[model samples]
Target chain A: MRRIMVCVKRVVDYNVRIRVKPDGTGVVLDGVKMSVNPFDEIALEEALRIKERGEADEVVAVSIGPDDAQQQLRTALAMGADRAILVKTTDVVEPLAAAQVFLTLVQKEQPQLVILGKQAIDDDAAQTGQMLAALWDRPQATFASKVELAGAAALVTREVDAGLETIEVDLPAVVTTDLRLNEPRYVKLPDIMKAKKKPLDVVELASTGVSAGETLKSVLVEPPKPRSKGVMVKDVAGLVDALKKKGLL
Target chain B: MATVLIVGEHDGSKLNPSTARCVTCAAQISGAEVHVALFGADLAAVAPQAAALKGVTKVLSVANPANAHPLAAVLAPQVVALAGPYTHVLGPSTTFGKDLMPRVAALLGVPQVSDAMSVDGPYKFKRPTYAGNAIVTVEAPESRKLVATVRTASFEAAPQGGQAAVEAVAVSVPLPTHTRFVSVSAANSDRPDLQTAAKVVSGGRALGSKENFQLIYSLADRMGAAVGASRAAVDAGYASNELQVGQTGKIIAPELYVAIGISGAIQHLTGIKDARTIVAINKDAEAPIFEIADYGLVGDLFQILPELEKSLA
Candidate 1:
């Protein structure tokens, strides 16, 4: 079957104001709103669109996180994925190990394309997609704003610091979604109900034979230093004068 | 002694300033020897610039026809081949390094430290997460090679006084053919690049339309500054993708940053957090951008921008 595998991550909702704990351990996550990582949602949306456009036959949503990550996978299904897979794990997975897990699944699933977010909002690592492509020994098009399937190759327009860079990659490649890709569609209530019946499989991290390596030890997490209080300028003239005094004009 | 290999970025001619920033980060390691690697079809014009960085001890130039365009798949193998003598492999956190470094890490079978804002120790680093709202201190394994991307905004560019030897290294790794560079559509602007500009003027959705964004450009041009835009402005099509300045876009630390008609979303604030002087011009007096701004002006940007331009003139 012509299939596209989309990887979604459950993270703190984008709108929430994340606060670090007073103990310098980590951010407070108790009762914080959790949703699909915004970039991953765009990835899933692109996968579903390709399926809808008949460029592919099925869209499979996959996620590697706690068991609660199933919630995000269900949201993916509601957004029009054919099925979902949850690689259950309680510990936080680093990017390299996460890439290994995806590589393992890719061997079994054998999908034509693997799509994922460029970076998770929580860690902002932005490494998994490229690492996966390297482990899989396939082409990677990261920070993709546009993807078009043409025959056995896909044309991807990437958002880079230089500008809009367009590249073409053969099939069985990996693509990472960027912010400008597409606005994800909202899931309807009826689709949510229907998604419950969809085949959502759960696999243990141990069974995948990929150990989540803690190559990096977390020393501590702290809030960023607060900026000094600012002065309010009355008009452009005052602002210009203030800047000139600072030798910034 | 810590041996560091810095992957130099360039456009086939001149070395990017971001590479010099990486050199500054690499030089922070105690008892360190820093080397830079440049890859392109021809490095005749760029190799000297890489060797001139003050802390750089050597420059390895890998010239090949296939490396003219930096496809990560083609470059990762070559980087891995040259990975033998280095304790750390570092690149800039810009888009080029973000795309290429992880692949090198994976190929080397080691985890990568992305966007290292501070070098705590040889294996320890601090990076920003949650869109720069939080900082995390992480220490990689000393047993393995450390691969990291240096946050360019967090460090100054390395001075150009060194006379390191430039060597031509022949890496005979098989390059991948699955990926091909089609073309790049870049804005042919005479203004300075947004990432490295000393001064920047940015607009937001409040500009209303792309035409009104010219006010930002006019003011920037007057000040010899680069033009940037909030993600909202880019989403509204008031600016191009490359002009975006925020967490999801370019993180800049220009000496002076002017945010006109920007509501100062946290994501946008993250990008300019390191800027030396911040000036916010917004109609809303309570915009969060004013909280961090050194100077805040609450007024209509339409009238203020013109007056600001004239006053500068």
Candidate 2:
């Protein structure tokens, strides 16, 4: 039986306007609503669909972060993952370090497939899956929009800058989800109740015995430079007149 | 002295302008010796272009039959083999670089900094996150090797003038057969590339259908501009994600940007905020794009587009 692992992350909701902290430390998170990363939700949806299609036997959802991150794991559980694991850590894990943590999980679970969001919205690093694939020495298909399973391989279509590119990778590989993959199914109260009963194991980051050892560090953060405000013209003729005056014509 | 090695991206015959931009980014790091590695079966045509970049110290052309197509698996080991003396390895934060650099970073046992907007120090970088709303300054351990991808939009392309030396390098890494190049379905057009275009014309969901997008193309063609679309337009299948201009899509900053029938969402705004002159044509008087537009013409796009086209003509 083929088992798959899906990784999810908790991030600030996409709708709110993000603000920098008073100090040059990080973005303001107090009272800001947090939800599962949309790309991760799409990843979980893909895993569930794969399981439903009988291509996989079970789906495991995992997350590595602070205790609040458990809600993200539970959301994955509610979405029908067989079990959930939260690798608790007090410190922030950089992309490579985060990949190391996932590497530890893969060693224990040994799932045939590992899926992750192409990028976490919070950092927008988009390197964990690729790093994990490289560390594991397994094939990877990043930014996958369409995924199909064959006997010993999976064909994935990627959303690249040029166009959709399709590639086939052997089984036991890593796949990352993109936006156009599928619309995630909505969760219901009944599913939430069932998710509560599902097995959610908590493991300490130290127990994993993986250390990224401070590769990239965040020294300070500030808001991006603001664009100067512009004048609103009345009509197309007025716009053309303004452009011509600005020598942009 | 710290040395930076740039993994060059090229289409078989011509070198990509992104490579020159990488050189410009490397130039920002004071006193760093910038070397470009051009790997392809035929580098004779492209090596000279890389060599002429102003900041580059030398071009390492590794002419190999296996490097005809940039399979990350095949290129990662080669880059790692060549990264012996360099303190940092860099690539452009494009599809090619994003696909190739992380593997090189992993092989070299280092974490790569993605989408670096500015260099604060030899080891510190500022990058945008949460759809470019906030910029974060990331520092790296000065002791270890560093790898990063330069955000092309933030820096200008290195001017071509200085004649850097091109040296032939040997490939030492073993090639893998697991990944192969499949068919490419690129949208071939003669219009300017969206990222580098001086002028851009974009449409939104209000443009209605995929067929209606021809109006955008016609207008862009007349101005020798590139065509872009909002995420709403791409999501509705009116345009491909490649042409989508938003936070999650291509962030651009053309000199002249015209938005048609688009109500600007924050995500969309994030992509075009850097654009020099913004002209918005939306029916909604309260559309957020107006707040930033140098010229906001509120009217129905269906009626306004033909008039605008004629005015350009």
Candidate 3:
């Protein structure tokens, strides 16, 4: 492969407990730390490894969001991406519009391989990669646990509902990562410094001619109702009693 | 009034329970004419089950040899072609449905409402974000067809009583060939599926190795519970990815969840928050798993596991 692209997203760190805003506008994100999505990190790590293995000439990291999302793209560069592109969008760019933007990039960049996280931890839509592949009429392998590149095809092992399924997609395919694909390498301070000088092109999302469809829109936001106060049983005996009393035993 | 198309998830022979759950989600739409679509090598044994779902108006079958496998590329266009006049198209939010429904939505040039948790009307809906921490209510435009994947966990299965009409439809959409099915190594199990199971017993990295995981299976077998594991255990090579119950893995809401030696990361807790009653057994007294647990036993799991098993037996 000559060039490979990795799609990343900036989202709430996996550790923080997300709370809803009192106004029901959205989640409280005033001060929450945002990082490269964990699954996206794995996807970028895979692309970097593919480049390091001399399988690709360069690895490009792409993200479509607000300007702050450029920070996530820079993190990808620190992790060894050759370059980055930020499709800056202030609007809540839904998956379809995001896919259209990526499609524009695909036509411009012409990367042989495109890899992305199976789903973003934020919206959890998990649709962009699949939608992109379909719009491009390219083969797609979603929830891939393992991906191995050969001469003209990629052997992808996917985590499906039934179990692990392995499929072979021809070159120029979209691969969405599942967890356990690989342990993303930690970026050192020196790499971060090096990434400061790397090329990161910011493109206006509106300039791409992609219109957000009328398919879906958010109207309200709320936190999941917390479970009732639960008792800590002294032993298994108490557990059984609790279950029996609830008619669940 | 909207005609909602419910895509049936099946392995050719039996319909996945999530399909019925998707029907339940569709039933929430006011004046919904729900239609269930079955596409496989043979729907002889599965069509009737779809027809029996309450609120369904019809069960459409597309029996094509190519559909022996649920390849998204092959199935997406077929669903799109049959989705004519449908104001809404829905599938269960499972591995199969997640893989299939989005492509169908895209092929129709419509933005898909994924993981929809509740329905207010034909276009307005609620869905979870940030891993179920926040539920966002959204509205799709009324001019075009809306497509969604129902969060099967949020609704119970539709009651089975309606005698929906069964019709075999002929589709001629040219299927994609670039994506081909090779072989699938399914984690064959006789116990109830982890997603649909009433009770689940999950182990953690403390299980040590793949062999020690047998204890989890033994206990789950005795309890007639499905087996699940933490991402750490799966990453440590102690279990398959299918059994990993976490934010990145399967999101399940079993009635009785027994977590053993799990440190209860927030990501892992996201998978089981909907569980009715949770029991945690761990050596660490302050493992986060205990925070939401209905019952906690702070002790050595090595000793407690055997004792608990013997008591249950």
Candidate 4:
């Protein structure tokens, strides 16, 4: 039986307007709400697709954050993961350290294939999957738009600048899902109820011997001034002339 | 002292124009000894170009058959292994760089800073967040080394002066087992590379249809600028996904950026935050783009674009 692990992150829903606090330490999510990151939901979909096809025997969803992140795990479970693991940490973990926690979880889970969103919505540093592959000394692929099971290995199509490139790698590899990978499914009310009863194992980051103190040394965040209004041009010719006059053409 | 490893992007025999810009960024961060690593089958043909870039003290050429087609998975580990001695690794924020560097940083147990515009200290770097709407400075403390992908347009490609000595390093790395490139289909366009272009012309959903995007193309061609589009335009099928520029799409920072019929959303603004000058042309005077535009024009883009094209002609 093949074991697949999908990493999920709880983030401020993409639709919300996230404001960075003046302290630059955390974002102020006042009226805005949070949810599982969109890309990670795509990752979860890919994992479920593999399982639905019988390519894998079991699918597990994992997340590293505070207890509130369990919501994301439940979201993944509702999407069809067999179970979930929540590596509880205080606040957000730096990208590298988060990768370390992922490495530890991978060691414990021993899944044949690991998948993650290309990057997190909040940090936007798509490094965890790559770092996990490196630390485990496993072959890895990033930004995969498609993945197919080929014998004991996986054939993946990755999106690049020029076009798509297909690669075949052995199993027990790390793959990061991109936006083009697959459309994630919406959790039906029935599945949402089932997810609440699904088994969720919570582990503390300190238990893994990884210190968060040395995680984020230098951190800065600032909010951009809101855009006011835009001006419309009359037509193409006029727009061109206007831009030229402004030295922007 | 921590050494810095800078990856050089080249087409077999020639280094990319942005390679120098990455080298300059490496030089800015203290405790860094810059080493340029060139990978491909045609290292000898590419060596001279890598040697010509200033601030590159040493060049390591990895020639192998597996490297003929560059992929992030194949290149990430090699970068991590070569980064053994360096405290920081730097690469240009091109598609290849952006795809590979973060993976490399993750492999080496270091935090990877993506699209950083400035570096304040050894591990502290400032990068645009929220698509360029705001800036965030971050520090990676756990790992001894730091990896940063520099926005090419934000830094000037350093002048070529001193010729560095090139060393032929045999490709000792194991062959990539998981993935291999089957083929690549390149799109031929008259526009410059969007990430490095000095000027960019973008359109939005207000253009209404795919045919209308021709106005953006014409203006871009007239100005010799790259073409871009808002997410709404791309989703509306007015332009290709490759042309989309927003929070969820490609980020660009050019000398000048022109937005026609785009109501600057925060997501769209994040992508163009580094552009030195911004000009917005839209029909709605109260559109969000005007607040950030250095010069704002209130008119219909359909009429303004053609006029701008004629003036340039």
Candidate DockQ values, in order, are 0.92, 0.76, 0.76, 0.48
Sort by TM-score, top down from the best: 1, 2, 3, 4
iRMSD values, candidates in order: 0.6, 1.3, 1.2, 3.4
Which runs in model 2 stand beyond 4 Å of their true positions?
A212-214
| Candidate that beats the other on DockQ, 1 or 4, i.e. the better one | 1
Question: Which tens-of-lDDT digit does each residue in B130-185 have in candidate 3?
Answer: 88889889998888888899888778888889899999987898887777788999
| Model with the higher DockQ, candidate 1 or 3 | 1
Least lDDT summed over 10 consecutive residues: which range in candidate 1 chain A?
A210-219
> Per-residue lDDT for B128 in model 1?
97
For residues B62-155, write the lDDT of model 4, one tens digit per residue: 8877788777778876877687777778888776787778678776656678877776877787876544545777776735677789877667
Per-residue accuracy of model 3 over A189-248 as CA lDDT, tens digit each: 999999999999998877888865434656789888887766777777777777778877
lDDT of each: 0.95, 0.87, 0.88, 0.78
Candidate 3 ranges with C-alpha deviation above 4 Å: A212-215
Model 3, residue A80: C-alpha shift (Å): 1.3
Share of real interface contacts recovered by each model? 0.92, 0.77, 0.78, 0.57
Writing each residue's lDDT as its tens digit, candidate 2 over B64-178 gives 9888877677788899999999998999888788878888888777888998888888888999898887888888888889999988878888998969999999887678767
TM-score of 1: 0.99
* Tens digit of per-residue lDDT, candidate 4, span A123-177: 6766677777777777677778789988788888876555466777788898988
Alpha carbon lDDT at B62, candidate 1? 98
Q: After TM-score superposition, what is the CA distance of residue B45 in candidate 2 from its true location, in Å?
A: 2.3
Kindly give the number of clashing pairs for every candidate: 0, 1, 2, 46
Best by DockQ: 1
